[model samples]
Target: MSSAEKDKSPTKEVDTDELYQKTKDEIRPKLEYLRSVDDYCTSEAYEAISLIRETCKSLGRSKEKISKRVVDFMLEKGLAKLIVKILRSLVKRNDKSAYESRAKTHSVAKILQSNVKSREKKKVRIELVKCGIAYPLLQDLGACDPNTEDPRQRIRIITDLFSLRLLTEYDNPSVIPIYRSAKAVDILMKFAQVEYAIIQVRSLMLLATIVNEEESSRIVASGECILTFVEMLQKAIDSKDHHYLFDIKIDEENEKEFFMTGNRLTEGLNNLASNDANKSAIIQYGGVATLTSILRSQTSKGEKQEAIEALWKLSFVESNVEVILAHLNFDTAALEELKKMKSSDDSKLRDASTGLLHQLEMINIHDEPPEEKGSSDDQCHDPPPSYEETMSGMNVMISYNWDHQERAIQIRDKLKQKGFNVWMDVDKMRGNILKAMADGVEKADAILMCFSRKYKGSACCQAEANYAFKLRKPIIPVKVEQDYDADGWVGIVTGMDMYISAYSDAVMEKNWSQLFGELESIEKKD
Candidate 1:
């Protein structure tokens, strides 16, 4: 090779053999120092031992040989101080590699393995993986000869792992394998202590993700775990500790996924909610209180939104709403908090409050006395007005694009010609346009939303549409542009239908007349 080629070539490869020797030289004293401690086999102490063992393994040294060195080192260095120093250092670094190395230690796996049996090892494996431990090490731990003959010992190991904050990862699919095992399920159901708030919350979220609804239902119905999880969330919400909230940012992004799981859990719980005993149990366990607290807290906007949606789902059970309404009434702080939300600039907050108000209205309406059955004279009450008469008296609110003002004016003229009261911005008070539109919407018999591609992008229009939908008024969607599509707004109204009207002055003039005729037809039907 020429001089340039030589310069470009890599330097002599470091001998793997020499590197292994060098690593052992550096770690030997540290290992010796760690083993001298009295609680040397304790979880944290074992974690330090595991780290040294893993470092040796990474350097291609045999664990058996390193284990001998560690024993020798512990004999010489006073194990307790060495282990404490190592753990403290690793904790300070807060490095991912250190965590990984700590996870892979044979000592750690041995400690985990000794607590469980062969048949029930999967739970230990899951618990380890959740705790940010390496899955391969967990697998190796599972393959190890377990100390106990009793199968329940395995469940105890799993519970211990959970209590140790070992299973914390929410995105890992490896957990599914453990959840699928009956032994693992039993252990999860019976495990009395949860190590960390994150673990409990993640487990609840994970239970929501199980594809099998029956299995999911069983897990949620376990009583012990569900109640425990609810209590955990309640404590976190009440304490207002963000650390305990765990992955709040990520949860916000995957909220819909959580909701899908939560909805299933809710369905299972709703059956329980039907029973007065179960309902009280749920309330006493802090489910309703926790949910309300979350709504009132300084949580992520997404969490607040999800909590509202969850409350709505829970409200389907008749008893659930009564509980929520009671909370809303007596919890002055919570009531004030929600009332403050109504004035928020966020459209979502406004929409949620509107939905809640509508629900309250529905509940009240259901409690009202039924109308008298005899109505022959009531039916003939001055002979109900004809469709044209109704149209003439009814007010129609129009939401149209500013760029299409002339068309809106023309349409307003046509409606007025039919003797109908029309409230378009052109004819209404100029200041506080939104307030004026809201007032018109409240009083109008119907709202005519002029739909176009531009309409969807308008915040004002969306707010108005949301308000109209909340009011349960008939919204007649008139499509003026070919680009306009009604599919997006379909969820807002089932009675609302799309109508196409021409944009040209002459054609629009003709369509406006037809539009009134259609309105007259609807009025007659009503």
Candidate 2:
């Protein structure tokens, strides 16, 4: 054999391939036996992971053999179809409870190994193709949930796909289109708005991958995408939620995950802003001020670096320069912070500091800069606004179970045209689902709790209603379905009384007008 050929990794060697096949052949019967059982997240599956690992080790074959066997078993048992069902019902979560559950389930798939080697991951993806698992997996991503399924399922599916996409060349036309058809891009943006720090960060990691392209980046920036990052940066600065991962009762490892995610999202924004149109979108929506705030805040070094990088990227756009200069906290403390960084140990950071100073000098921005109002885009349509401020009348928070999202969105858009600030997940849900929900409920002057026949039992809906009650935010119920009856927990939140009905087309306008009246007249109680 040629020396060059011999230099190839074991993965490339045909002898290893034969060894893997032999190992698989030995385990195939046992795998079949395990697959017959109903679930794989139990003891039998954990045992299977160990068995496959041991068997591959005994044969002197690589771990890819084990991952391949696991994939083979899941496919052989037609588990992919079941996974699709899981994503469908996933939305109907237990949202009504006053206490938020902090439990996280262990990933049965990870038992294939905690962090599959890239080679093994590739092999597993290949074996999945060989076993015909990809088709069903892709099918699940594209299949529309029966509009009545829990909306949280989209969050679940997107989270699930992160690993699958990483395992293969998900960027390929065949696979990517399925995600696109599933509106995966939009799903991710909404995913970002969620409040759970881990999920929020995870969603941003996935979005960073998606927004690598010029067109995709522009699309994301033009929407609620950049605005979402601004919110995250603000939270990171205000709450420092990830800083004390121990102080917070979240997952141990997620502490690092949270910090890393912050950096990843900052980098994602940096990348998205590289495109001229997207940079404009970022600047137009007050992204510049938020990023500069990050630079000035007591955030972690990596996060601050990302903010610096984002500023550096934004500076490339000439139109964005004035806004950046205007919002830069050029007070002595801010300037001193920038100047001190010029002699940093990190070369990248030193360069970023020096460039920022040079730019400041060129612009003659020697004083504390003036505060800039809203994005250039919004100035054309409304009054001066903060980063969180939308075109406003009533700052409305619409809470509904996913089953009735179609109606919820219609109400949201209707309110928007009428100049009310509506916070509905359907339109612009991003970063940290639970946190977003909590923050929305807390900030809104009122909430429009949309319901349908299936809504009475919805944990998500009830949870929002309960949260609003906790905060003393008045909930105005707008029923889109004719048959939904308010009872049990629903009655507790909305009162055992009548609500607005949109049953007939003739009363739609009058019903909405009345809802608006409630929005305008209801005084917010502290």
Candidate 3:
């Protein structure tokens, strides 16, 4: 053939017809034996299953269709129940077959992790779930003994850890809740507490994915896991050479691990700290110092910014601010790092760092001890008018998420047209938002609580609404997002309060008038 002709030749595709015939011939006998035997030898089961696993894995690397067809055939032969049953027995055995057992567990995890068609993967996962695969895999994970002297055992442990982590990364919604039910969360948390950095990182990644608000709140209430997460950050900061916590080499894949681990650790801490009661727990558990260490470490920009954000959220609490200041006194570099980042070329980092500093400054100003009344100059510097006196006649404060800002403004205009005094942050207050929000809520007679998913997610809105609730201001819940029911903290804060629907133009036209009437009723009752 000519060189040009050779170069132009299409790449050879795998012969699906031949591959299918060969794959069935290879696994059908083993599948038949496993299905027929009610009591099978461990070694025999491992041998048969591992061979099928390897054959399918090899095919999957080249073509998903061929591997998927093979998996379908195995499922048709009831491989899911057979594998789970065998896995349960093997994981319970403490003999020499332990390594093989973990290897089998790893095989199933790999199967689930395969890049098959999504529908096929979902089918496989559902079948595994029905067969109770999570219990044995979690059992193996909980029982994993990282034998330092034996490299094979260690490799098996790492394989199991990676496999379990992959299950967490899978998109199937059925997996996590089932895993959670099988006590997978507590087991994963136990795994994270192990001394191995790789184990800890993998476990933490799974926890960050599956932990709900209630679970996180429980973690904070117990005050156990919060410090462990904070210490992971401290480890990263203290390591002279990077990758000390994760122990990964400086490759593209390992670098990603470093980045992801950092993000997940910070994210976990951030989520835990979002709960108001947890704020003091975190501060007491040395979270402030560990977070500050992250700011000073050679972590990724995103990770450092997240640390700043967590700190920013913690700063909302007055007592927590005191703890942060105490930490800042000794670790001056953390404050300097934050100050330097205020001018960062990265917009998000700059804004976050700047916002954190602004919050600290506001806290300091509010917490300052007042001067004595003896001096005339001090008398002349008397405190400014109270919110009630200065912003008199404001009827309601419209607190809404920025995503629904247009809706908020529309509501504000309508109120104003009816000669009702309303307060909404249309100017988009940047750094000094907390104080502005306090002022708005403090001045108004009622707070218009705009309920949406984004509204519930916003830390600023939470702070605003909580402050309003704290001051005993009447909160009028306004439904802004259709089909969204308030839950978690939002649900508790707005508990049993009547919600007025204004989710769409039609709904608003019908129900928006109810808001004005409610405000009038509140005013008259006051």
Q: Which candidate's lDDT is highest?
A: 3
Q: Which prediction has the highest TM-score against the true structure? A: 3
Q: Rate the local accuracy (lDDT) of all candidates.
A: 0.48, 0.52, 0.68
Rank order by lDDT, top first?
Answer: 3, 2, 1
Model 2: residue 333 alpha-carbon error in angstroms: 3.6
lDDT of 1 by residue, 77-133 (tens): 443234333333443232445544333343344333333333223444454444433
Going through the candidates in order, what is the number of backbone clashes in each? 13, 17, 0
After superposition, the stretches of candidate 2 with alpha carbons farther than 4 Å from their true spots are 1-138, 144-155, 161-205, 211-214, 217-222, 243-261, 329-334, 354-526
lDDT of 3 by residue, 352-396 (tens): 675677666733323333333432222333232233222226567
Using all chains and alpha carbons, the TM-scores for the candidates as numbered come to 0.34, 0.41, 0.53
- Give me the displacement of residue 270 in model 2, in angstroms: 2.4
